[model samples]
Target: MQELKAALERQALAEGFAKMRVTRPDAIPEAMGRLRAFLAEGQHGQMDWMAERAHWRGDPAALWPEARAVVMLAETYTPEADPRAATLLHDRGAISVYAQGKDYHDLVKRRLKRLGRWLIEEARGRGSAAEIKVFVDTAPVMEKPLAQAAGLGWQGKHTNLLARDLGNWFFLGAIFTTLELPPDAPETSHCGRCTACLDACPTQAFPAPYQLDARRCISYLTIEHRGPVAPELRGLLGNRIYGCDDCLAACPWNKFAATARDIGYAARQGSPPLAELAALDDTAFRARFAGSPIKRIGRDRMVRNVLYAIGNSDDPTLAPAARARLADPDPAVAEAARWALARLGIAIVDNPDMPEP
Candidate 1:
């Protein structure tokens, strides 16, 4: 079993995983309690799926009755540029680091399954009957808490897992194995007296040091909210179209982190000038965001987010672009376009083609 654990670590690193740890599945009791409290308080807002499958999500043992050990993995996908710097350049929309390129759910899962295959083979060679199941964020598994318990990292004050080596920039994944590998010592919290993450939020999404009110989060509003944004939060969203990274960028631990080697995660064209983004029609938007996570939000939601950014723009020249979207088929987009025109001091007519402002 010791030789098998050592072999798995080598295979994991070769597969581009930055860190790996094995731990007993029972180490997440505290995290289960915290997650239950978060759901009970209605912090998840309209994301009811988090509460819908509470039985499986609240306990890892319940998720897979046969699993005895969990192999938690971390993949480093740090953005090339500072995710915060673009936010200060209000002329450009700020896309979160995680969405910079290919969707991580696809990227991480492919590699995890490969690792799982090797684990199964190694166990069978030892005449052991072992089952392996892999998961990314899409599963009922609580990845951050599982990573912490596996000793890959600690859950920071922002409620995201952070490692001294990988920083807070990496994406998390996990594999449950029936091989019963030796468990590693859990990582302890290092976020002492540091309120950098909580204070850095433009929308004050963090209700406290470790608690997040997802309803107030710009990331949730732009990506998950299905309708018109709350009017008060529109202006505060600034040029952040997809998601916000203020909490992650503010962490001091990132100084030790290295930039990602995977060019697949680099920033692409849809992260464009806010004015130009307002010009995209449904067809153009689909073509532009092909293979990108932004496409999942669809044209209406993307344009709705662009309109909010346009409204925050102090440039009057952007008014023409804003006015052009007033007749958008999506009511949320049309309403947001009207709101942007008002911000630019432009008068709106029923027709969007009523000459340039």
Candidate 2:
């Protein structure tokens, strides 16, 4: 199994994975309890799926009874520049560094499948019947905890997996296999007293040092939550349109994280003018973000988020962008437009269309 493990690591690297380690299916003993508590407190917000699949996600062994090992891998997508700089561009909408490129689900999963197939072939050649399942973020899998269990990284105080060497910019992918493998020692948190990630959140999403309240998170508000965001938090959203990267970028470990090797992870969707984004109809939005993860959020949600960004932009020049969406078809988009207009101090008197700032 040690030889197989070595071979697997080599194959994973060849498949473009940054790091790979093996762990027992039941390695993450505390995952179920933490997940239960997080759900009990309603911290997941609109993501009811977490509660729905708690049984499987809490225990990887339970997800697949015969699985003897969880092969955790990291796929780096570190941004070439500071993502926070884009958030400061008042007229532009800031997309998270991860989403600025192709959807990682497609990218990582394809590589995982390739690696998994190689593992099966290599194991059978050694006279072992190997059964496996590969999973990205979409599956009912607690990858961060499992990654920590495999010694790939520890879950930082911000609740994302960050390696001392790999920083905070990698994606996690899992391959559960029936062939027993040597498990790596688990990694413990190195965050210590550092509050870098906690202090950088624009919406103060962190309830405490390590706990997160998704309901108040700008990433969740912009991407997950439907309808208009809470008025108080709308202004706090600033220019972030897709997802917020403040906490991740704030981590000191990022200094060691290398930029992405795969050109597909490059920033093809750099910050665009809020006016341009706000005007995207369904077809245009779909075409613009065809291979992007942003496409999943749909045109109305994107426009709704753009209007919110416009509201928080503070630049009066972006007012027309918000004003035009006041009569948008989607109730949420229209509401966001009105809020943006009001935030800019442009009174929407009798007409749904506001004059100017």
Candidate 3:
């Protein structure tokens, strides 16, 4: 079993995974209580799926009862350039580092499936039978906790996994098998007294160390929350039209982060002008982001986010982009346009005598 484990680790690294660790399916026993507390406090906001699959997500043993060992893998996607630099370009939209390239879901899953196939064949050749299943972020699995239990990394105060060596700039994937491989010692938190991630949030989304309120998180507001955002939070959105990476990029451990080995993760979606994104129709939006994770948000939400970014740009030249979306078919887009125009100090009155909104 130890020999198989060692060989699997070598294969995983060859497959582009930076690290791989193993643990029993039932190793994360304490995660159930933590998940319950997070959901019970309504911290997840509009992500109803978290609550829907609470049982299976909280307990990986229950997710697949026959699975004996959970193999956690990490793949680096560290940006070559400073990811936070785009936010300074007021007229351009700030895209999160993770979405700057091809969608990680497809990339990571492909590697995992290939690795699983090899494991099955390798086990059989070794006179043992093995069955395996692979999963990426799309599953109900609590990947961070599972990864920690496998000794791959520990969850930081920001509630994202960070390793002493791997840092925080990586994506996690998992493979559950019916083979009872030796389990590694679970990693303990090394965050200590650091508060860099907490202080870095533009919206103060962290209520306390290790606790996040998705309602105030810019990422959730821009990506997951539907319709117009609260008037107060709009200014805080800055020029970030997609997801926010402030917390992850702010981690000090990232100094030791590995360079991304997958050429597919190279930045293709550079910071695009807000004017260009705001003008995109449904078909244009889909075509522009065909293979990207940003396509999932659709045009309505994307344009709405662009409008909010325009509102926060502090550039009067961006008012026209906001004005063009005033009559957008989607009410959220129209509302965001009005908010942007107002923020840009532009008057919007249907009648000459009427007061500007």
Candidate 4:
């Protein structure tokens, strides 16, 4: 078992994973209870899918009873530049580091498939049958807790997995298998008396240490919540058009984070001008964000987020971009355009002033 574990670790490292560790299927028994509490408190926001697959998400063993071991791998996407620097560029749209390049879901899944196939071939040589399944961020599986259980990292005060070595700039991939691999020691919290992440939150999304209210989270508001954003939170979003990284960037542990090995996660063309992004029509938006995770949001939703940033930008120069979208067919985009125009104090002569409903 020890020899097999060593071999698996080597294979994972060769496959471009930063860290790999194994845990039993039932290692995270407490996660389900915490998940239920979080759901009952209505903290998941518009992601109702969290409630729909509560059972499978809460218990990975339930997702696949045949799986005896869960291998959790971390792939770093740490930004070359300080992610917080983008926030200060109020006239530019700050895209989260994770979405700056090709979609990680596609990148990580391809690696997992390669590793899974290798594991199966390895097991066959040893006269053992190995059945496996791989999942990236899209699955209902509770990745953070599972990663912690595998001795990868602890869920930090910000609720993101942070390691003594790797920090919080990685994506997690899981390989569940019938082969009973030796489990590693679970990681314990290293965050002692540190509120840096909580204090750094622009929206105060953390209700308490180790708990996150996603409804108040800027990342959720920008990416998940459809239609016009709640007017109150729009100002707090700053220039972050796609996702927020305040908490992740604030972690002191990030000083030890390794540079991302995958060049695919590198920031593209720097941060694009907010005025330019706001000017994108559906076709232009699709082309610009091709192969990017940002493409999934589509033009209407992306434009709505851009309008919110333009409103908070304090640069009246972006008013023209906002005005162009005032007559957008999508009510949400038009509403956001109106809000931006109002904040910029630019009144359009042809458009009647409509108060925010």
Candidate 5:
């Protein structure tokens, strides 16, 4: 089992994974209690799916009773340049580093499938039967806790997994197997007395250390939340049109982080001009974000988010782009346009009844 574990680690590294570790399916026993508490408090906001699959998400053992080991893998998608600099360029849209290029779900899942196949062949050669299932972020799997159990990294104060070596710039992938692979020593929390991530949240999403309120998170507001964002939080969004990376960028551990090795994770055009992104119609938006994770939000939601950024930009030059979206078919888009015009102090002559910001 130890020999197979060593070989699996080598296979994972060769397959472009930054790090890989193993843990028993029942390793994260405390996670179930925390999950229930989070759900009860309605901290997940509009992400009701978290509550729906509570049993599976909290307990991996229950998720797959046959699975003896959970292999957690980390794939680094660290940005080449400082993501915080994008916020200063108010005329441009600040996209999260993770969504700046190719969709990680596609990239990570493909690598996981390849690794699983290799593991299956290796097990067969050893006269052992292996049945494996691979998962990226799509499943109800509690990857962060599982990763910590597998010694990948500890959940930082920001509630993101960060290590002494890898920082918080990696995406997690998991492989549940029937093989009872030897587990690694669990990683202990190294984020002692660090309040950087909490203090850096634009929306003050962290209610306490290691606790996140998704409703106030810019990432959730921009990506997951459908329809209009709450007026109170719109101004705080700044130039962030997609997911925000303020907490991740503020991590001191990131000083040790390395730039992504995969070309697919590289920034496409740095920060795209906010005016140009705002001007994109459905067809144009689809073409621009093809193969990118941002495409999942669809044109209306993307445009809506862009309008909010334009409102907060204080760049009067972008008012024209926001004005063009005033008559958008989606009510949310039109509402966002009105809000932007109001913020820019641009009088809406056509829509006399447009409300104040």
Candidate 6:
């Protein structure tokens, strides 16, 4: 078992995992309380799934009694260039670090399976048949808390894990194993007196120091939310078409973070011109975002998000792009595009005084 643990650590590091830790399957007491309070306050917006699996999400052992230990892994995927730098060009869209590359869900899961297979093989040789399962953000697991507890890092004020060495720009995955690996001491929080992330949110999603209201989060508005964004928050969203990173990029501890090693996760497609994105048809949308996580939202919702971004672009040239989308086949996209074009002063002269429905 000792040899297995050592070998697992060696192989994990060799496989490009920045940090790894073993943890007991336990509920994070402090985080559980915060989560319960957040859910009770209805801060999760239309994401009812967070509330649906509350019990299991809060407790790891309850999720699977057969699992004896948890293997938490962190992969750093920081971009070489500043992710927030492009946001200053308000006419251009700002893609979050996580979304700027190939989907981490698939990439992380495949590597985790390799790690798990190694663990199982090593355990089997030592007279134990280990049952293992790898998860990347797909389950009802409270991954952030578990990652923090596993000593990968402490949860930052933005409620995401941050390591002194890895920073907040990373992907988290876990392997639930039946082996009893020795657990490491957890990391401590260091977000003392820092309100940078909280203050930087465009929509002020962070209601308090550590609390987040997903309803107002631009990441949710552009990615998860399926319909037209609230008119009031449209301008605030800026040109972040896919996801928002105001809070993540605002963190001060990211100075020591390493650049991404896997080229597969690098930002491609030139940050995507807002005007071009608003004009994508269904086939073009799928082809462009193929193998990317953004495709999950489908063409209509994706274009709907782009239209809102166009409205916030503040560039009259983008007005024509939004106007072109006004007749989009999808009603949701058409309506949002119409709203954008109107806001950009491209509407018919007769409808000059009209407001968006």
User: Which of the predicted structures, 4 or 6, would earn the higher TM-score when compared with the native?
Assistant: 4
- Residue 220 in candidate 2 has what lDDT? 94
Global lDDT of each candidate: 0.85, 0.91, 0.93, 0.92, 0.92, 0.82
Per-residue lDDT tens digits for candidate 4, residues 216-305, read: 999999899987777889899998898888999999999999778888887774678989988889999999999999999899899999
Tens digit of lDDT per residue, candidate 5, span 220-283? 9999999999999999999898999999989989888856777899888478898888888889
Which residue ranges in model 2 land beyond 4 Å of their true spot? 351-357
> What C-alpha RMSD separates each model from the true structure?
2.6, 2.3, 2.2, 1.6, 1.7, 2.4
- Identify the superior model by TM-score, candidate 5 or candidate 6: 5
**Can you list the residue pairs that collide in candidate 3?**
none
Of candidate 6, the 10-residue stretch with the lowest lDDT total is 348-357
- The list of candidate 6 runs beyond 4 A from truth reads 349-357
TM-score of each: 0.95, 0.97, 0.97, 0.97, 0.97, 0.94
lDDT of 1 by residue, 1-357 (tens): 878899999999999888899887788887678878999999998988989888788789899989999999888888666778777656668888888888888889999999999889888998887789999987898888788888999989888989998789998889998888998988999988989999989999988887899999999999999989898989899999999999998899998776676677877753589877888888998898888888889988988898888888777778888887877767898889888888878876767443222
What local lDDT does model 3 show for residue 34? 89
In terms of lDDT, the poorest run of 10 residues in model 3 is 348-357
Per-residue alpha-carbon lDDT of candidate 2 for residues 1-357, written as tens digits (9 for 90 to 100): 899999999999888999998899899888999999999999898899999999999999899999999999999999988999998899999999999999999999999999999999999999999999999999999999999999999999899999988999999999999999999999999998999999999888998987999999988998999877888898898889999999999999998996677889988999998899999999999999999999999999999889888888777788888878777778888888888888888887566353222
Give per-residue CA lDDT, model 3, range 96-187, as digits (tens): 99999999999999999999999999999999999999999988999999999889999898889999998899999999999999999999
Q: How far in Å is the alpha carbon of 325 misplaced in model 1?
A: 1.6
Candidate 4 deviation (Cα RMSD): 1.6
Best by lDDT: 3
- What's the distance in Å from true for residue 279, model 3? 0.4
Which residue runs of candidate 3 sit more than 4 Å off their true CA positions?
Answer: 351-357
